[model samples]
Target: MTWFLISIAALIGGYFIYGTFVEKVFGINEKLATPAHAQNDGVDYVPMSTPKVYLVQLLNIAGVGPIFGPIMGALYGPAALLWIVIGCVFAGAVHDYFSGMLSVRNNGASVPTITGRYLGNGAKHFMNIFAIILLLLVGVVFVSAPAGMLTNLANEQGGLEISKTTMVVAIFAYYIIATIVPVDKIIGRFYPLFGALLIFMSVGLITAVGFSSEHTIMGGYAISDMFTNLNPNDMPLWPALFITIACGAISGFHATQSPLMARCMKNEKNGRFVFYGAMIGEGVIAIIWCTLALSFFGSVDALSDAVHNGGPGNVVYSSSFGLLGTFGGILAFLGVVILPITSGDTAFRSSRLILAEYFNMEQKSLNKRLLMAVPLFVIGAILTQVDFGIIWRYFGFANQSTATIMLWTAAAYLLRHNKLHWICTVPAVFMTTVCIAFIMNNATLGFGLPMTISTTIGIVSALAITAYVVKVSKGKGDTELADEEKPKSAPETV
Candidate 1:
């Protein structure tokens, strides 16, 4: 029965969420423009074919979050997957698709740029600062949590000496590859080949594990029982669930991904497939990983043992691939590397866009090596000293706050221009309400809230700014603003 409900929810979510990408919410056809074209620079600004763009965008946005978030969400029982699937389609997918479309229409402007142009300079600067802080936090959490997970994997199966230095070297190698390789060429030629190999390996691993006699299927525990059994000092399901879904459902990073891909999309018609399809792919990955975690761990005690002795990565890898012996373990390790590399690349690209926009650097003229190298090193170094578990917890709340602010900005824009679509508005409202509710609950319960103080402050400031923008916008009247700039036609087909 639970599986049935989950299936239905997934289908519904996938359809609606993916549908938004296909259905142009804003009639964006007229607004698409020829992206400022230049010579192929073999690095950051390499022009990509539509298919290549789609793959890179998909791989970039769908990464470790799908795996880690779902594993964490499983603590609330399989029921949480329902919310993760639904919220992602309605909220996360919408935000990503439209944000990308908006960016593409504006010639690859970041969210803050779009907010600034549509909202105001004050809102733009504020959001930019907020985004940078969020990115750093995300980078810290991203690198450390995954590194810890990798460390765990190494210790258990490979019987290899897993240390911080080795993990750091592996991550550095990934960044170097990402820096020199043109994303277009990589996605166009290498990604398809690698993606196919990854899919086959992932399926084989799942099948091998599933068929193994070593696995056990216990009746899933109730969320209430699960929490009651936990130590009071430990993080609870309610807060953890909120944090887990923050990325899959809503994340500021999506805003960055959306715009860059939107610019490269051959036609606005492809947006639906690339944007929404990628999101659904992410959700599916999350669901699979979470199920693996639950099946492998079996109980909270087992989970704790893995975490305490091996770390979260150990818990994740053992639970995920333990049933399949050596092959499973190797596959799992390789999978971990692939997933994080995709994420790191996306993060690097998004961070570069934000920095370039902030400093008024020509998008095409920016140096990819410096852009990728500096942030990757800085984030990697910062992560080495931090406790990733705590950072992971904070990621949820901070991500929710970032999503909330972005949605609010989008909602205000729609309402102000009287161009509001129910599709976008509904998700915006739903996401905002849920995030705000989660924030309030976490704060009241003294669960340390999922986000940092900086994020909390940013959310509050964004709300105030949004409210003021709306109020001022109302006074100016929609007609005046609408007349200020005419909507352009979509760029002519190549």
Candidate 2:
């Protein structure tokens, strides 16, 4: 209970303290015209109020990441609390802010295009393909997870039964339509509704956990207990925890989603509120769910048993029902069902935009959008037949890996401008370490190397990248970095 309360305090306090410092360092200028005003198309690039943009940004990034990831992460003990709080404020929020602000400054270019501008085409091309694949994986995972959940609920209730394949078809169809539609049509308008439900769920869970005497305060591991790995599998806390806990802490995928809102932001000053603020909000949600899982289950062993018996989805449902009853079940439905659908659609939309930006294809028309999306959705649908567990494992590695690349891009942008590059460079180096260690130590991906060997490789990789980035920065004057030309807007593919 004490740790939970302090984690909550950290999120709120970080926004006012560190968030403000970051806002100032990024040098927000309200007077500066954002891409929304500079490049409004009445479609994807229309300006929106800060609040609406904040909601969309929040929902887009939140998905099942904070809820589901942290539930699983809770298995690692109270250490999840440390990572979500500290990681969100320092690493995650910082990553989101730089990525969003960079897009706003660069004509709302996708991360890939921005990477291309700062790094070379080689890096840009790799990121472009990597990001799209990651987004597609996200789309597929979200669709399957929700569809499977709905199927379970139908079976349990014995009403309105639906096959998983049918749910997949319906969800993918929605993704295709959402992808091709303009921003204001489906996503911009309805995202707030979803955002409200998400907030309600977060608040509901937090309230339930706080009020329940049976909640078993400090049920699992305390802060002191966190120093050792309590994971049932003895999963090392280093790479596994960081990678598993990405969204609540920091995710590379947020960089892709930021450009969607970046196109709609009317002023540069709103970037902090929209990007940094949303990440902190997500951290709060993650903390709530993780707390509920730990408190309601009464012990780490109990929580693990619940997870093993019914999976993470069951953890959510049983915890919610156990606390708030029927309404809690509704919240569980929202978290388990609706949240992923919202993110899944946007993932596809972002992919469309990235592809359009990459080929310099204008997205003002439906044909151009569909041309990019049809094949993408088909591939996503095909992926639904494959086991979701495998897809998600790859997705975790890919998601953080993409974030590592974006951090490098952000670091390069800061260096070229001769601004303080350490903010991004340091986190970039750390995540660089995390990604490498996870890749090397995982039995599925690597040779099941010892954590010691993996840690050494991770450290070396991080130091090498840092040295190279610094060396490249030293060779070029600030003017040279600034003079790296931005891409010209592509001709409208009418």
TM-score for each predicted model, relative to the true structure: 0.80, 0.95
lDDT of 1: 0.60
In candidate 2, what are the lDDT values of residues 385-445, reduced to their tens digit? 8887798888888989988888888788778767777778888988999999888888997
> Which TM-score value belongs to model 2?
0.95
Candidates' lDDT values, in order?
Answer: 0.60, 0.83
Top of the candidates by TM-score: 2
Each prediction's total of clashing residue pairs, residues at least 3 apart in sequence or on different chains, is: 12, 0
Cand. 1 TM to true fold? 0.80
> Per-residue lDDT of 34-119 in model 1, one digit per residue for the tens?
34232223445445566667666766776667766665565555655666677777777767776776665566677888777666
